[model samples]
Target: MIWPLDGASSDVVFNTWSHFSLSLNLEAASFTRYITPTKVEQKVRHLVIEWIRNEIVRHIPDAEVLVFGSTPVDMYLPSGDIDLVVQSKSLAVEGPPRSNITRIADILRSTDMALGEVRIFASAKIPILKFVSRHGKFSIDISVNVSNGVAAASIIRDFIRDIPGVKPLSLIVKCFLRSRDANEVYRGGLSSYLVVCMVIYFFQTHKGMRKSHTDPSSSLGNLLLEFLQLFGYDFNYLQSGISLRDGGKTFSRSERHWIYRPSQPRLCIEDPQNTQLDAGAGIHDIRRIQMLFIHAYDQLQAEIQRRDRSRSKALLLEGNSLLQIIMGVPLNVSATGPRWIAIDKANARKSSIGSILPCSIPQGDSIDY
Candidate 1:
């Protein structure tokens, strides 16, 4: 069962996020070395690796299991969890295995090892093996799958590792994209991959980049474009609203809008100029409402002037009030706005002045509201 620990922690200080250690010696080249695994990490990884190697030998002798990630060597797997991929040419394709939980529990019980409380679940979609440790309740996930036509793991792993500066570039871009999404909307509707792609495209055509901006991380931007074209979804819709599961519990989604648009967003780390350009674009949609209002007012004003009788003017205003109401601004404020023949709106702004009705056009439009 899921625990009710939502909002249990106190609010983190605003400065806490900004307090990352600054090392003058750090270079983009040094990022690879900076990510050295901790001691606990080393112990947990070695323990899992040894147990798996032994288990495969004992349980299914002569069967070779493909071992990679942290186990085979000190590879920097971002998941931080020890990932072991097992080849399955025969037997059953499975998710995390429940029996592996019992097997792990039995193994840990006899040994004086620090690791504890192993759990395995077999579902069709995810890793076939999962191990849980008592210390910090740390866990490692292992997936077992048959070799498809393409070994996607090797392809991605090789590309990042072999390419110069790819990992650092990717890490920087990932952090920036995630931060932008969080500040833009507390939860993100678009995937991180999509955000990365958008930023890359903005920079690729940006023209003012330094020579160092040549990492393979730009490929993610390409992947994102392909995905968007293949699956048509409005990019702007991602800014609308997002929902998240809290404390492993579900609830109906809710939204909070930013009442004011940012003049210049500091969170966008891609092309600073492009972000400013887009903000103007988002605000310019109001110009359409301007034109719609003007056209409506011109036509409505002429119609009212043609009909000298004021008694039936109110009926005409009510009939064509849709454009103003939809735009949430008064019709007289718009081009198609009504003007009262007798009401002088210019004098209405005075402290002790004219009628409450604005004098833009057809006098009857005010009654529709």
Candidate 2:
């Protein structure tokens, strides 16, 4: 478990500025900093990724193991899982042999490998092999082929490096979604991949707005609020779908080759690499999810308004309430002696934190994935 610093000890620069400025600037900075995972967590994930890669190779000499998803993109949360794709060019083309994933799971489960809770989902659409390290520092998902995930990870990493505010803004939106209990797709909510795509699309369309904010952080905060507002109040799920490749421009169902059906998800996000697949397919309740986005928008607006009034007491409550509602308690990692906590099945919200990898894409846009 990672323990974050308490308010008294946190590196917040509030006292130096005027009350209003402090409340607006420092609070925003603190919220972002508090949610961003520490470097140690990143290091542990990297080590776990390497170990999973080696274990897969040790078992299948010809197998190719490639790390993808958030681990590669560097946007993973403290509770995130590592995503690995196992492929042998020959096996990848023909698809998994009936027992392929099982054998790999067995190899990784051997006592020498020091991995635990090895489970193989052979019947899954992608056929995943899931395992947690014996130390419980991290969990990983292994799949066959699925190079598309790797390709998407590469695209995200490049965006982080090339784009000014992509990383922080994406991270902020993701944390917001996670806080609202809307980030897990398997639970019929938004996927982290979809959230990222949404953030990227916003950035693409709102590049002009970046000039309005003085710094990257403020721009990110503003963009995040706008993102929530857009999805919550303005986006028309029934009438349109989001296309990141097309600069986040909306496409009509007919023009984009999307057939509207009652059974399909309310929102349609074209996969960046595979346009045929809908990344937001798991979103079963559009109204409920949009309500969450709106709720967050309301909370953020309240906090900003309190800051404007210079009501420190009210501001603190609203700020903390917003953070608590969104991110659970700020994990006191320093106090939690363990470097990593085992995935708790009881905590349904955080259990699937790192499970979804952003690889699926929607149609349109200038830059081809």
Candidate 3:
């Protein structure tokens, strides 16, 4: 269903694809603009960061708090959590002392800054203190001496700067995976870093894309279709592994010893910086995720065919219903700005001081397109 039927004329096929492509391009633009953080939201985030930094430094004098993950690169979604790494020379080589983490949690709970009960997972591979900021309502995950996360953020930032379509495409893909509860690594879904690597690899290895003179940014609709087709139907998960090193490469999973247990055939993606590590090793439900991509592609193709049969230029120009459906964005959602802005307005009316704070719209809302 990814391509036109054999009996379809060339002109008809071209027209159908062209119309769908244009619709997708418009949808992607509108969605990006709507989800992008406003200036006021950015200020609130800064204030939250500073408040947390001061609190941590007050208790642990030598501790230096650093921001990492999506916030620095401006690629985060509206509902994204904040990632902070606390580093100090006084801390043990293994990690911060358990007493320090517990003390930090206690201090946060006693303060007005922490919105809810602070949870500390001291036994985790990388122990972390998790809490929500009362100021911006942003979820914060704090880890000690995790330098690798900081390095990964810098690398992803460079990729976004050099690649034309990475930002928008990544945002869309993140939203898609998040809606299905398949974007959290701990929950057996791909992490944001893994998702970005997949996208970069797709751009690098696509044969038609490399040869075409047209800029990939201009043809995101077609590129999205092809991306889904490649990963959903064509990718050989059992044998092949994705790599972004040396521009991009596909290697045999067995050769690299990246293969999972025989009972579980999962996706393998080698960390560009660390050959020994497989970034996608955590994705245990990759098969279901792949099938979701296939279903989304089929749904989009069906919508295109339906429009083609109707011969409705108005439908094509108005918006892309299938794209919205796949992204879990409601057809009625405004393209002018995020839905949180309206929620903030309501919150401002209820508060004694007329102040607006950023809020997250719950994802996975049913789409009635």
Per-residue accuracy of model 3 over 264-300 as CA lDDT, tens digit each: 6678988866778988887888898898789878877
Cα error, candidate 2, residue 179 (Å):
2.7
Q: Which wins on TM-score, candidate 2 or candidate 3?
A: 3
**C-alpha lDDT of all candidate models, in order:** 0.33, 0.61, 0.69
Question: Which has the better lDDT: candidate 1, or candidate 3?
Answer: 3
C-alpha lDDT of residue 257 in model 3: 79
For residue 161, model 3's alpha carbon misses the true position, in angstroms, by: 1.6
Q: Which stretches of candidate 2 lie over 4 Å from their true place?
A: 1-8, 13-25, 90-98, 112-116, 210-214, 262-265, 310-322, 328-369
Output the number of the TM-score-best candidate: 3
Supply the global lDDT for candidate 2.
0.61
Worst 10 residues of 2 by lDDT: 360-369
lDDT of 1 by residue, 250-329 (tens): 11111233223444221112112232122222232322322332443344344434433443445343332321222234
Candidate topping lDDT: 3
Please write out the lDDT profile of model 2 over residues 211-278, one tens digit for every residue.
45456665454566677788899887877888777455777765766665744438788888787777
- Candidate 1, position 92, lDDT: 44
In model 3, where do residues sit more than 4 Å from their true spots? 1-18, 93-97, 211-215, 313-320, 329-369
Candidate numbers, best TM-score first, in rank order: 3, 2, 1
Q: What is the lDDT of residue 34 in candidate 2?
A: 53
